[model samples]
Target: MNYPEFLSYDIALAACAALAVLITLLLLKAFALRHLQRLADSGRLHILRYAEQVVSSTRLPFFTGVALLAGVSQIKLSPMQDRWINYAWVVILVSQIALWGSRIISVAIGNAVARQRTADPATATHLLLAGLAGRILLWSTAALVMLDNLGFNITTLMASLGIGGIAVALAVQNILGDVFSSVSIALDKPFVIGDFIIVDNYMGTVEHVGLKTTRLRSLSGEQIVFSNAELLKCRIRNYRRMQERRVVFEFGIAYETPQQEVERLPQTLMEIVSADYLQTRFDRAHFKGYGESGLMFEVVYHVLDADYNVYMDIQQEINLALLTVLRERNVSFAYPRRMVHVTHLAEPQESAGQAGKLAA
Candidate 1:
């Protein structure tokens, strides 16, 4: 067997060619990314974002393998060498495909989530979970494909995995429940981030939504975390949705005030409430009825703004104006009082003399 002294020079030449090709591919990738980034920066082809993502995740292994094939034509190889090269490339091709496919799923889901983020931030969390699930599925399926291409029977493997997956799910059932509850919370819009809510007895602004729990920033400046399932179960009072605040206040006037003045009390209250014309709407001002010590007047108004500070400001102004006007009208604020009659009491001096006689 004249073993052909196949010179090592041919192998060296092939190695050099493969190295050159890999370097060229890398430079091309860098240049392509830079160009794509420019296109993205131009702010015109918004579609370039997805393209950039593809190029970004894009690996050169596939091209590297292809470049290695170029050297194959240059060499006189044994059947064993050729077969080994073929198998190696086949594995590379599968990996590259899986890489690209997974990236595409991620990019698409990211874009979808971004669009939904602007339209509705609540949906973004749920969409993020969906994106994660999709990526997992894609990569797992890709792994199966890779194994199958390597001459393994995936039918039995998939069947076995199905049972294993079920067992794993059961083991983490509580965690999974919370995860799904977060999705449900996002979809249902129970309360979005930044909303001030009172759930059961806990009151706070929602800060973040997580797979297991939702976090809140309480008025006391502490962060409160609630399990998504428990949060959903609790009754939520969303004060963030309030448009206006209805306020009712009552005051008393001296019973000695004239009947005419008492009749005029309702008009005075209307004037007082309307003093801050822009912030409040006078609902009703009534001389409600006689009280134990005085005449009671009830005033009802609606603050036009949802801000607590604004409500307080308007109420304070009304109170100041009412006090001034009531004084001008000689209307005195009433206080509780009682009168006791000394109809049958002995004089103090006579009582003292009687005490002295008893002592003697």
Candidate 2:
């Protein structure tokens, strides 16, 4: 065949191939979606089921289209040009396949690990960390593969990347520290989502754990982001870990109260704390000392939970109960007072009377 006939034949062949691929992709999509529907109807499908189906069905046609277009482009190019074009297209297609395949495999593995971790609470956090690490590794590998396919010397490229990454690490040493700290936090399970934490007076619940920063939803409904490095360095009080919270309170009794009543104060406060459901375990009470205006007594007890609201409620109830008991027992709180003497006036009157008698 002459050059023009050869060109025509190639064009026709490429068109036929493109049409066949398009039609095949459409049929495959339909078959896969139908299979997904059947699985969904069987009640065996989970969160990952639909996700896998969508990714597979979408990528199949998308990649088929890319390949077809690349093939058609190759047909119109010179031999040398076609070689480069084919290389680029193959790289693109391979990268896409790697990405999609990695995603599917990751999803399946993550789901399986999650299911197993659910049974073992201790492993849940580890599984979550593993899942995230897998995703990062997958994408990183995909990127390297694409670069390698583009005629780049992978060994040299990797060495250069390592050097550059080291520079970046040095430049953002603090940030990198925080990111690693966040990973440690996740793995250690120091605090999880919805746990209340106190860090340097910033009290809030952990809302999210991200790559570099952690988000906290404050009691006032404000979102706060803290660097994980700084957070890990600071003293973190996780209230959720407290089995029981200790409540300590002080009250004053009037000095005028009888000695016997004052001695009975400690026992009375203990009884009050022990009688309430809010008190987990009562420790002890003491007549601490005399205050500026009153006699002070200290009461201590533990609450069942570390929740702020629950603690406050228990404290309030105990206070009210204490007041009621004190009033019934005729124990009155103290108030400041002053006493004045009139001795000078009395002496002057007596002297004046003596002077009058002498004159008479």
Candidate 3:
């Protein structure tokens, strides 16, 4: 064929190929959209929804490959154009492959970790740390792959990156420290997501552990974010780990009660605690001493559960039981009282003195 004719043929072939690829992409998009709509309508096809996501993710890479092949087959270009085409093809292919691979690997790792953690339920913080770590590793791998495919010596690039990273770390030392501390928290498993923890004045449940900061949902329903570095520096109290809750209560008895009964009160209180189901064990009961208005006893016991409401209920039951036992034993509770004495011989003495004066 003549040169002009060959050129025209090449152009026509390329255009046709491009058109076909476009048409296919549109059809795929429509199919995916229809699947999504169906899933939404059913509200039970979670698997189908996931399939749609997978299909959608491949659309970009699929179109890129199609376009590259079409261009190579239809273009009879100069050597320069040929090289350009080759370079473009290599760059796009490497980058797209790296991206898709990274995503797939990330998802797979996450799923495996999640499954493994099912037996040993992990907290939200743990899951967050795992996810963030996976993403960082994935993206780092992708970046390295891209650079290597572009003919850059990875050894030199890696060395340069290391040096640059060191400088950046020094610049943001506090942030880096927090980030590392977050990792430590995740590994150490100091507190879980739903655990109620107190750090200095902040008391809350952990909502999320991010790269730089940890989010807490306070009891008051406000969200607070703290740097992991700062959090680690503070003294933390985790209430979730409490094995038992201790309660100490003081009760007053009337001072009119016999001294001997007051002395025996500690033993009686101990018996009451030991006999109660709500009270785990009797720690101690002491006749602490006299109070301003009554005799005082200090009662101490441990609750079996650390739950606040449960503790309260148990305590209430114990108190009521003690009161009932005291009533049945005819023991009156103490209250403040005072007695007064007065001399009254003045009126008689004055009458006698008046009678003596009249006789004189």
Candidate 4:
């Protein structure tokens, strides 16, 4: 039986050496990771945690391939075989690097999110998205680098991708717009989950902030969905951020209200607002103007609390108190009324006869 020309004692030795290297590498990886884990668990060195994660991510296949490449480099082979081995080595190296980068990004972002989870949940959510984006970018760059190392024309590939990407972007432009807008919302923090927001005619509490759509739980017990892109385009009133509720309300009194009471109305309103048990900051109250059917007064005050229910309660109390005071003062609440003054007009003959009598 004739053996292949490449099979020789040197090759046999190289094979044994490769096996030893592989075993050594595996053992080293195990021991190093175990030691690092212990150290990391001790919480003495913060950086060992990262090292442990990166080292543990080292795959058995990658170690095996590395050992094989090292052994093969010591042996003589055909030019084609050498080229293939080099390509394989490049792939292993790039993949491992990508893994390390991905691990680092995950760790860093995860720590950030954890730290901010309670302090600022919105930022934590944004960090999660950022981590995903980073990992994607890392892997994409690694793939491109691996391809370039394997003798692919990267520039031409990139140009083709650019054109293809444009077409794909055009096809999914709306989705992409919403996705980008979601990022904007996350970064800018225009609104966050649990924030009561008003956009145009829609008002609701933000239930979920998603890449494509934000869900809102409306007061009417229905979920309102809005495209993130369109949501950002509209004016958003974030009521959650309001520290106090500024309330402006107007009421009219009967035009027959006494002048002295009207003069004292502003102070009366201030007392009513300030005297309420619920916390309120009186801004101002004035006899604003004369309405079509009555005298209008505008009152502005601030509820010390941001809660809508609390504001409503305070307002109700104020209304009831005002009603009582008005009744006591004989001031009636105004209603829509039309008062017509009629004048009798004599016929043309009567007017002419009166004129003739005056002349005679």
Candidate 5:
């Protein structure tokens, strides 16, 4: 194509300068990226992960912005051209900074979550929200800066957005509240996934923690879901967190049972407990008092683990063992009974007997 003779030299010079700047920055970016790859391959990236983030996120736009600024500076241009170049560079700067900031947010939050992964498996929730928050902040600031650089009134725009945001918040207050509660659950970690918890009347293992609701797999083999906000308001009994389970049981023996047998009952119970002390702690066993129809005995013990199935199995074993011991000894458990007495009175026949004697 034919170029205007008067502008040919200037155009060639500008093109050459732009190419030089672009190539130089590209080489620099390539070097940084190679270093990052080396760190990754050596398994040492964990220590320099932040530096990696900066390098990776800035690789493209960082060089582009520098090249464009250099190219524009090397050539003379009208006011309009200068303004356009400035806007383009500012966009690249804002975009690159936002990208790097977002990566930083991700790395920081991920490290924190990794540290807490053992304690709270819902850590991903917190990490996600934190990274989202950081990106929103970065982009929002970039937007404001871009507008200000473009000579717009940021204060008025922010005020308008504030009012609109309030309206939006009102429209979705419940949803927003639940979202915040989910964030709280993520951070505070009252109960995590797979934790058996009792919330109000609902008992289950948490299956999912979501922005709106938490899902549970109930004992009845069905799913139960509750709003995150409502769940936070309830009293939650996290059975999974219990280190041990305290058990109390009472039984009645017949009143006719001998005192010797009554005394031996406790010993039998102790033996039964001692036979299986692997996970149970024997507390006490004694004849408590007299019931309406029998003698009452109370026993206390603790299961060393929080598993409900384990606890129930051990309890059933104890119950069966106690029954067997009593049966073997011919000791009987009590049931309600009653005793009745009958008395007959002789009726008086004194008048009849006297009349008969007179007639005779």
Candidate 6:
């Protein structure tokens, strides 16, 4: 190729080559991105979505840097200048790779969350935190790689960071503890959003599970918030996980009732409970013990449903049935009462004699 006197053939050729490579890379990237988007939108292949995300994340600066690096490699330059240029190239490549890695992580996490969002909201929430941590780790590694290429002591720097990290950890130990507890909650799944949970003295429906705190909507229309760390330390009763509810109830009839009827009470109870066998399973009904006012009968059963309302409805029907049966059988529910009798007696023989003497 012919060139002007001021410009050498090699320099001109290098310049032309750099320009061509830059244009080619840009055109190829655009074409691939457009194709990948179409494939990703079709949802036929999940890998295409990830590829699209990575390709789209490639910034123009990276393309320019790569082209400049390619063109400069063909030119004559001082050793120090070449070394710096190589360092710049490493930075550009590592940064873009880190960006692509971050996008991939987000895409993966987002897809996973979407899949589980309807069935397992708590898991979806945890996946977001996991993605953030993954991206942070990816970028940190990329930075370290760039530093290593640029002739920095990464091992020493890591050691220093380790020591400093300990102090920082100690300073923010409370926050870190809650974060760890949030991770534990996600993994262990003690309770999830929409679960009716009882923690210590507080009972509520789980409204939100956050990194530091978990919030609940109480039955009485109050919001209760608990630190995740503290929540983990306490016992959690997740009613949503319960399959059936066990019920124990005690009632008393008048002690004056016939012994024959008392003996038949257990059988009567069994019949009453077994009538709703589809909803309840009768365990036992027995004359438990004597109460101050009546003979106490204890009944144990399990409601086949976990819903509180269903249990209450079944209980109410059983109670009304008991009332009707007792009334028909001429038996009465017990009430606290006392009986007193007054006896008229001669005041006293001595007092009577004294009164007689005084009258005489």
TM-scores of the candidates in the order shown: 0.68, 0.76, 0.73, 0.61, 0.63, 0.63
* Cα lDDT over the full model 2: 0.77
lDDT (tens digit, per residue) of candidate 6 on 34-123: 999998889999788789888888878888888888887787779999998889888988888888888889889889978876798778
lDDT of 2 by residue, 1-360 (tens): 899999899888888777777777678767777777777677785654745455564655465756477458737777887767767676767666666666676666566656755365335445556667777887788777777777779999888989999899999998889879978987787887667899998989886676688889998999989988888888989887799888888888888899999988788777778874654688999999998778988888888877778889888888898888889989898777676776645588899999999999
lDDT of each: 0.82, 0.77, 0.76, 0.90, 0.83, 0.89
Clashes of each: 0, 0, 4, 0, 0, 0
Q: Give the winner by TM-score: 1 or 4.
A: 1
lDDT (Cα, 0-100) at 93 in candidate 3? 68
TM-score result, candidate 4? 0.61
Error of 1 at 236 (Å): 1.4
Rank list by lDDT: 4, 6, 5, 1, 2, 3
Off by over 4 Å in 6: 1-111, 117-129, 138-157, 340-360
Q: How far is candidate 5 from the true structure (C-alpha RMSD, Å)?
A: 8.5
By descending TM-score, how would the candidates be arranged?
A: 2, 3, 1, 6, 5, 4
For residue 304, give model 1's deviation from the true position in Å.
4.8
User: For model 1, what is the error of residue 220's alpha carbon versus the real structure, in angstroms, after optimal superposition?
Assistant: 6.2
> What is the lDDT for 211 in model 3?
73
Error of 3 at 167 (Å): 1.9
Candidate 3 residue pairs that clash: 253-334, 254-333, 254-334, 254-335
Candidate 5 lDDT at 87 equals 86
Off by over 4 Å in 3: 1-16, 25-53, 59-73, 76-78, 109-127, 258-261, 326-360
lDDT per residue (tens digit) for residues 1-360 in model 3? 998998888888888887787677778788887878688579877545445544556666567576656656678778887766766776666666655655564565456556644454355456657766776776687678767766789999889989999899899998889888888888887776667889888898876667788788998999989888888888889997899998999988876787777777788778777874554778999988878878888888888888888988877777898789778767777666776798776688899999999999
Candidate 4's residue-wise lDDT over 1-360, tens digit each? 346645676688788878988999999999999999999999999999899989888889888888888888878779999999889889989999999999989899889977876688687778777887889899999999999999999999999999999999999999999999988988889887678899999999887777799999999999999999999999999998999999999999999998999999999999999984769999999999989889999999999999989999999999999999999999999999987899999999999999999999
Best by lDDT: 4
